[model samples]
Target: MNDVKPRPAGLRAVPSAVWALGFVSLLMDVSSEIIHALLPIYLVSGLGASMLTVGLIEGIAEATASITKVFSGALSDWMGKRKWLAVLGYGLAACTKPIFPLAGSVGWLVAARFIDRIGKGIRGAPRDALIADVTPPHLRGASFGLRQSLDTVGAFLGPALAVALMWLTVDNFRAVFWVAVIPAFLAVAVLVFAVAEPARAEPTRKARWPLSVAELKRLGPAYWQIVAIGFVFSLARFSEAFLILRAQAVGLTPMLVPLVLVLMNAAYALSAYPAGALSDRFDRLTVLKTGFALLVAADLVLAFTNGIEGVIAGVALWGLHMGFTQGLLAALVADAAPTELRGTAFGMFNLLTGVALLVASVLAGDLWERIGSRGTFLAGAALTVVALAALAATKAAGPGDGGSAEAASTKEP
Candidate 1:
């Protein structure tokens, strides 16, 4: 049977709420990426932190966010609302931007980063669930892709701005950070003023307890499978901070290091929407497999080549793999989870993957300190092969075979 109905064609078909959310993500990413692009260098050079310290800090910050997502996502479900939680999360993150410039030590920055990620955790699952709630299944892939694409636009733009600003200010990191604050508040304003949660149908029931055994069992085997794949995938991909560090190690001056993120995210922004749209017409797993292979290639390039050109090529491949996989993975989670549990599903997925990332980042840092960048990336490549094997094993159970039946009942207009 045809699971999706014929709908309006192209981006026009996507709901306005999705666009509003995308812009919110775009603005926030702009604010965050500015600090992020410069943060590793700042930690290592400015604060005199070690590579392992950076890794631990990045890993812990993300793990904190992922852990927080479970609660915030569940709270959204319990309240039967998503918009306000998202707003609060964005507001909190916006508030934290000023702290970056003022931070006097690694400890202060760590606190700010931890709090910022808590805000990220709070918003991520609910915002994603909101997207799934508003968009039709037929357009789900495109809608997620659009948001990813727009968010990535800010990702590159922030670094590009950082590059220019650094030059103009003679490498004034704090000045660039101060400029980053504007877009963050703009993100909050847009979320508050432009986006409205669509009305739920009658008989809307609050989830009794989103994390209980019964509720989790309701998420089903397919959802669990996706989670497993996500965990492994995250293992293969460590924090992007490593990418910035890699560029710096290869003789890219401090002022120009942000260019690395600029290049990578440019490719990511360019590819995300097309990749999502492609997944809509074909097997998402196939597209994801191609992405996984690209990561392997990227890792090899980064590991073997020691020049700036090699770093550039590796970064581009990394971004391409991100574009191919991230949104599709999100869409798959939406496909596999029950409608009422979408937030919880996203939360759980992120939590596991976030933990994996923590492990990967720590291991990468250890390797980088011991055997150098080559060892770190070569390890990543090996892990990607393992993740690919897991993905291959998952192919036997398609996205349709999961919780789609239950989810479809709620999705039908």
Candidate 2:
């Protein structure tokens, strides 16, 4: 048997593309977080929209992203291109940010969200594929984790900036949105000037519009099982709007919600890279399972908590859960996929999770309306438990256990 060797530390130096992508993400997230942190309040207090409307908007946005992810990933693979698609996607989203400040009603806000999500859909899979293409397998987890950590640093900083801006403007949300334009444009500029698509090994066969299942199945059952587990986990998870609302319910003022977001993102940014490195050393699946458990605990905590202190603790837990899950899942997907089909694998993973979030948000909204916020929290906790059980059962089934051929295909090339 051939021994799989790890790359030398010097050979694992960060690529220019990684740094460029990280900059683009930082800028984009700064733009996104500024608007997103305040959107629920803008819609609710300013526009008098219902919780259901908030859920609907979130569901639609996620569904739009989900539907487009598969096609975009497959197209990028067929075309053997990544940078142009990424550029277009980021450009579209950047242009859409200004519309939020301009909008006078919920209808326009929804439209802005739709357009923004369309851009997200267009870029996500291709961008992930680009990351995979530029990095080698052994280093893939750490590379992706570094990107996530940097991206989330923006998430932390953006909301902190927004919090300061809100205080400066005396809670004028529109002004914050306007200020967001700067980072959005900067993100686009960075992507255009700094990022490059790496060359792909050409397929021997002719390119087709849609890839076949046979092609996709090469990713293995462990990959699909992980995706399935992600979907279940997503079903319990709703939009961050609910988190903001929960904070509000627990006595946090509207302006202070961004601060809470900053805290969560700080935790996420701090944990992501370390979690990724640990997964690289251990089994990625075990790390992911632990993340799911943390999420379950967060939901349960949120269900019963009412005090500001409790809410803070819950959000912190939620942050820890995000830290553990996000990059780890990406690593798991990379581990399960062939280099050629990695783009499609990511798209499929996102697609499933997106759909799950759409449904979950809608369900959460309805539950919140009917049974109150506590009910929604309980439902999320329950669903997480179910997802955990399924994951355990799948694991118990042994190698080929979860239908992922890639589980047993961990041999390095």
Candidate 3:
């Protein structure tokens, strides 16, 4: 611990490329969240879709992206390039932006969502890998946090913009979607021109076959532990669409519903960087435990309370958990996996979590239909208890054990 510097450098001390990547994420999130904030309402109220249908759509879209990430991440490692694949992903997402406004039917929305998520799938692993590639190992948590915080800044901004646009356009969903297309393309432009990929410490040209059993085996048990944790955490946390529904059930207006997201993301953006920096200085697992504790609190609050204020409190806690854990987990992945296979490791992690999310969302939707909103949240709290136990057990097993990434990290302050 004495080997490292005591004080952390400011954001300006990080590489310019990391800043550029953060902005790229920020703009794209601004575009995506603007559409996403209102999508459930649009499908249910405007298109007469069921809550189960909304759950299934959200689940399927994310699963598709998660599944696609494995291939893209592996391909980046195999091809010895991350930027081109990332550019392709952002461009594909930009192309799909116009489809949101043009859609008149459920099928159209589904297809457009599928395509847009494909773009996310393509870019996600590579972009994450690029962040790892560009930053110093010690600063990875902070780098990932900075990028996530910036992305969340867009997350809040997008919903806030949607609220404003809905008021101005008199509830025109299509127009807001139309406006979303601009920033997505702008994100692509910045990535292509502004960010520079750092030279890899090790050459990847020798390994063209990234999916071989030998290649897969190269990712040790430590990496797999991270994947398992991600899946369990994902199960306890389902689609945010349900949060919006809960708010509406509490009598929040259609336009004002987005404020829930704005508030949640505001908490997320505010805490992410500090949490990431904290992980770099402290035991990462201890920080993650705090996140798990917050989720449990959030679910219990949402389950027991019927008021909008309770929902507000729950959503804020949910965002704080997200802020505290997401970037730290990304840093853990970078720490455990071999540098050459970093992209593949992230893809696998996202893949398991993505599948878990689909299951969780579908189950939440079913539970909502069978019981009530309270039942749904209560179920979440129950699952969260299970996850918390698993996390504690993992922590007990020690850092060098398969379950803990602590052995892999460098927390020297």
Name the better of 1 and 3 by lDDT. Answer: 1
Steric overlap count per candidate: 0, 6, 0
- The alpha-carbon root-mean-square deviation between model 2 and the true structure, to one decimal in Å, is 3.8
Worst ten-residue run, lDDT, model 3? 396-405
CA lDDT scores, all candidates in order: 0.89, 0.82, 0.85
Where model 1 places Cα greater than 4 Å from the true spot, the runs are 1-5, 203-206, 396-403, 407-413
Candidate 3 C-alpha lDDT tens digits along 1-413: 47976544668766678889999999999999999999999999999999999989999999999999999999998887899999999999999999999999999999999999999999999999898877766677788899999999999999999999999999999999999999999999999999877776555324447677776666767677777888888987899999999899999999999998999899999988988877766777788888888988989988888799899999999899889888988888877776667788888888889999999999899999989888888888888788777777663222213223323322222
Supply the global lDDT for candidate 2: 0.82
TM-score of 2: 0.92
Among the numbered candidates, top lDDT falls to 1
What's the best-to-worst order under TM-score?
1, 3, 2
- lDDT for 355 in candidate 1 is 97
Give the range of the ten consecutive residues with the poorest summed lDDT in model 2: 396-405
Question: lDDT: which is higher, 1 or 2?
Answer: 1
TM-score of model 1 vs. true structure: 0.95
